[model samples]
Target: MRSKVGLVDLVTRYIIRQKGKKIRPLLVLLSSKLAGGINERSYRGAVLVELLHTATLIHDDVVDNADKRRGLWSINKVFKNKVAVLMGDYLLSRGLMIAVDGKDFDFLGVITNAVKRMSEGELLQIQKTRKLDIDEETYFKVISDKTASLIETCCTIGAMASTQNPELIEALRKYGHSLGMSFQIRDDILDYEGTSSITGKPVGGDIREKKITLPLIYSLNKVSKKEIDSIKKLIKSKNDSVAVKEIISFVKKQNGIEYAYNISRKFAEDAKNALTVFTDSQTKLALESLVDFVTERKN
Candidate 1:
């Protein structure tokens, strides 16, 4: 118990200062209370979601070779990639211990399954990186796994822990799924539409990494075959600043950003609709507000 407490402290000391919205943990708690009630077990599940989310950010910084996160030096920038990865693993282990020790077996299943899906999603994206022909259908599946799975897990576990009703659980899960998709699309759009000064990241970072996000994917679908070949060749050059700039401009002309934003709004609306079965409550209102927050977030 002492070791566990010490480990938790170490993890918290590293992450507690990080600036994030903590939306996932909020979802866990909100959904739980909306479904029926909140208890010690529900708070445990929310904490586990937060730990898992922080672990993912650590690992993602290592993989993306990102130096800055939330406008500050990331763990990888300060301690090197090895330390960052180990810290991520430590956080995951701590979350697991918390769940199992609390005897929240069902929550354990929710999170472990989400971790599995998240790993597979990352692998899938890595596998397709630099592949110019990645289609729209495949893009959705990857984002769904990488982003939506955990969001869904947060809501589902919250519902299950608070309510035994299968229907309510299912409704909240759908709400989460739609919200998660909207959230990812918004992030992808920010990579293109937002400034580094605002978003706290470099412009064209996704393009530099050869990530086929929504705007690029839409531009590819709308552009000519000749343009496609030109863009593909430039991306393969491995140092195609000129090409990256051109792609961003072309995406704007093609209304790719607008299209992606529309899609995000649609999902946000769908998320709100998913909660129609629930009677009005503060928790339900908070969930609806979360949908508005997703579309409005700048970073």
Candidate 2:
């Protein structure tokens, strides 16, 4: 659905055709079942999460000047940047309208906080990217806000919509947060380890973008001061294709990949541990399997 005035509807429809993994909505549904049972409210919450997620992807493509999304032309690439931005705004407003119409004020509050945290995280990353001064603590904070907050919202909203138990909601929130963290760390690792065909982007793309991800961060901490300085110079410089490749190699040689994997595994375990309060059921096992999928996914 789009404006009656122009090509917005067609473009929006095109975007909808390029569907993603729908992981967040799946989480909402699964969490609903885990907490209590699915209902109309659960479906509404899933729709809201998907809408906001799609909006964010539109906006992210514009900001990153991305040409491809999910192996297809990005909205900005096909519709132009201004149209993409307006479409993102349209989707965001539509999501807000759904919450308002449903009178789900509590859900609205959770989503609003997620949006705020995501914005703050993006800005903070941009600021740190200038200096490349990201430490371990800052890294966790950035991922928690930017990547985990919405996942947390999905699980929390799903449980809240279906169940009256505050404890169940809290448990799902923690589960989602830990799973999201592990998910993102795996994504970062893929940037260094996966091929273009597998990841839908060139390996070392993040390094070229000067993104100081967990692997690079862990490697930097382990190397000698001179080695660190050299690596920093390469990152701070133009970061051409060769330099990015070298940086990737250095990270691998320093065992950065292994270090990051270990950390990601720990978070995945924590995610599984969060579900212990629930009784054994197929829905619970599905949630547990999702943890394995997140940590083991190639893309």
Candidate 3:
């Protein structure tokens, strides 16, 4: 992130100071270690994935007009949308340059594909938000592209860095797919029930954004048509605080949270099962532990 520009340096400092969970890079490192051992390519792959993740998050903040990220002011809140958008582009360009300099075409292909999927997923989600009529399949499609693709890329790049064995690479990819699904499902659950102190972000941001998630989807199917319409109206209303509170209560009463937890757990199990390709080792254990952590994380 080094640059002659003073604002670029300043924004770089601001972003690094309060890094989030950093789960993507960790997956990269761990997968590389599990497959063989960490090398220079492993580090490069980690840096590229993290750059893409951060850039997307920065762009997302601008799109959402977000005030905070993690527990602090978002890039848009501090630097305004203009600077934030440019900063995201800067990070992306830096990542591309890094891959080009290293001649890591595999990394470049995976990252470019991820970028495409992320853009499509975000646009689809926006469309669904406007209509507020997302189904379970559509919900999966959104998260699979927007969230899961990033995680899958981490594992993909990492596996490529360590080995050319197609079986091993495919195994890690499958593991990443399920892990990402459970991770986003758990995240959606937290938006409804997580504590502000724990998650940093205020609860019910999804409802405020008019986003329908798995929990609400399951509950909506169980209720009467009249009740469902009323709940939808509450969500669509401009009164965010009241809507958030009422919707949270409604989702909990309808057992949406419980249903979501069960589903996330199943995905977690699937993630673990995918790791059966590798022999038992500390690295394998760590990878499996990540599955539990993603499903059970408070934030």
Candidate 4:
């Protein structure tokens, strides 16, 4: 099969070579291995998942107007918004092409569904912005739709690429869903508690953007109505440098970070348990260790 060298080369050479965790791709590989043996199809599928993830990051940076990622300038920062947008689109299109090359219509359908979910998730966040009364139900709904869905997709594709067992596919999907939720919760906690140097962005970027992440939601639940009003006002204000500090302090005082960590740990445990159906293997152990890494990662 002839590769689309130009588009693939542009994305791999320019966009995807930067420091990325490649977590989704890793999931694909690991899940595939745990269920069955690795194969050429699994490797290609892993690459496709990573490409799709990169495409989303490019688009996310443009939409969020974010400057830094992975401790470096975001593509939107270095390439300008228009180029960044097109680069993202190109990468997404390339991912589709790669999926087709896998010759699995079912896998293609799974990936297309993830793309749809991610689009809807972003739209949901945009629709809810600055409406700071974000409840727990809505918060989980948003994260599951936006973040967990794709991670679940990664595991689903991985299983199909290897063993093609319906039960194992469902099990790994559950594993990834729980892991993804924990991952996002950890991200929300880090936003409140981590240094910019560690997190690869400002400590309060979510607060500055007025994005109601998990910790903020927990803190909002704990605080009085008056405190919620204060937080809403602070988020709406332009000069919020000091307010960011105050919000962080308030969240910690309310045990917002701790609450989020507890929830994250629960999900991590659930993810580890999802592997019980699979027999003992190095890949399974790696998957279990990934849970601890998710909860313990500083960045």
Candidate 5:
């Protein structure tokens, strides 16, 4: 990610300093290893996934006007929105160029379609957040597009790079889809139940953003229209502490978290079940353990 320009180099350095978890690339590597062995194509796929993930995070920080990322000053906070946007664009173009130069046109097509889905998902969320009217089905649609598409694509790309077994590739793709769904659902649950010290985010941040996650969506359906209207008013009250606390308590009283947890567990089980195509191996076990880690992670 080096740049000839001094300012660009400075921004890139700052971004690299805050090392992310690199979970997406790790999944790519693991998937590749499961199929066969890590090769040049596998490395290319891993790099492509990381580059795309990083670009999205940079852009997300700008869109959210978030001051911090991973406990460090966000790119937009330090360098302003223009520079941050350019940096994200730079990463995106670089990732695409790598794919093109490597003649990974199939991978290019999949990733471009994922990017489109991600954009559509984000725009849809923005629209829903404005109205606070997202339903359970729409919630699934948003997470699938916004979060799951890239993850499933990572598995697809990994298998494509390292193996020709179509059945194995399809199995990994299903595993990734289920894993992604469970991962996002757990994230939504954490918003209602997790703490700042563990999750690196304040509780009720989603509520403050007026983002209707599954817990809230499910709870809203169970409550009377009167109670729902009251909670909606509180949410619209500009992040009032009373509003946040009450809505959280209301969701709990309605068993929202428990319901969401059961759903996440179902997806996690499906994720593990999708691995039946692979014979017993350490790589396969690692991938199965990854499913547990994502679903049960405190964050």
Candidate 6:
């Protein structure tokens, strides 16, 4: 994957080296195997999913003006914003090329819809953040679009590539969607509970960023109107470290973490239940384990 220019090649290598868990690609392969069998198309599907994921991460870092990713320098941090944006576009185009060259119109449709949903979700979050008005339903909608849609696309593509069973494909899609919801909720929980070393970001990063997640939303609902107003005012303020810490403590005291955990656990359970129709196999077990891992993972 060398480029004609040395700088582009260097940044590409850096990105490859900083790759995260590769969960999307793993879901592609696992779902393919569970549906029927893995083939060249399955491998291509995995590659395309990874390319899409990486491109999104690059763009996200630039959008967030993030300095670090996966505990390493973000592409925008190391290579500057323009180069990072171009590289993200280049990767996205490459992914599209793979789908077009393979004549995988279904996969193309899935990826395009995912990209649209993700963009919409991001814009929605930004809009809500401006008002600090994210409710539980709106938060769920945002996370479903931004995080779960791609995972659903990956599972659907894998099942489509491997088998012709519409039922199986639909089942896997639901499974992926549930798993993705659990995954993101757990990630949000970690923002309040996990260590920076494990999460690769500071605790309460979401609060500092003024992103009202599930825990805070539930906590807000449980508190008095005056307290809720105060919390919103604190979030709308400069979001200083002390204010974020206080908010985190208040959320915990209000049982926000417990409520979020219960909801995430239900989603994880739904994810496991979605695969029950599949014949028992190692792949099925692996997918179930993946559901558990998504909720339990430290990073």
- Across 1-299, the per-residue lDDT of candidate 1 in tens digits comes to 12455644654576677879888888999999999999888898998999899999999999989988787788888878887898888888988999999998988887998999999989989889846667789889899999999999999989988988999999999999999999999999998888888887878888888888988888888878998888777666665778778878888999999999999999999999999999998889999998998888997
Candidate number with the higher TM-score (2 or 5): 5
Write the residue-wise lDDT of candidate 5 on 84-112 in tens digits. Answer: 99999999998888899898887898789
Cα lDDT tens digits, model 6, 250-277, are 9999999999999999999999999988
What Cα-based lDDT does every candidate model obtain? 0.88, 0.92, 0.92, 0.85, 0.91, 0.92
| lDDT digits (tens) for residues 1-299 of candidate 4 | 22466644654565545877788989999999988977887888888888788889889989988887776778878778887887777777877887787676778888998889889988888778846666788888888888998999999888989886889999999999999999988988998989887676789888888888877788888778898898888888884799888888888988888898999999999999999999998899999999999989999
lDDT for model 5: 0.91
lDDT measured at residue 159 in model 1 versus the true structure, 0 to 100: 95
User: TM-score of model 1 relative to the true fold?
Assistant: 0.94
Off by over 4 Å in 4: 1-12
Against the true structure, what is each candidate's TM-score? Answer: 0.94, 0.98, 0.98, 0.94, 0.98, 0.98
Candidate 3 to native Cα RMSD, angstroms: 1.0
- The per-residue C-alpha lDDT of model 2 at residue 289 equals 99
Clashes of each: 0, 0, 0, 0, 0, 0
lDDT tens digits, residues 1-299, model 2? Answer: 55795687888788878979999999999999999999988988999999999999999999999999988899999989999999998888888888888888888999999999999999888988888889989999999999999999999999998998989999999999999999999999999999888777888888878889999999999989899889988887675887888899999999999999999999999999999999999999999999999999998
Residue 237's lDDT within candidate 4 is 81
lDDT at 140, model 6: 97
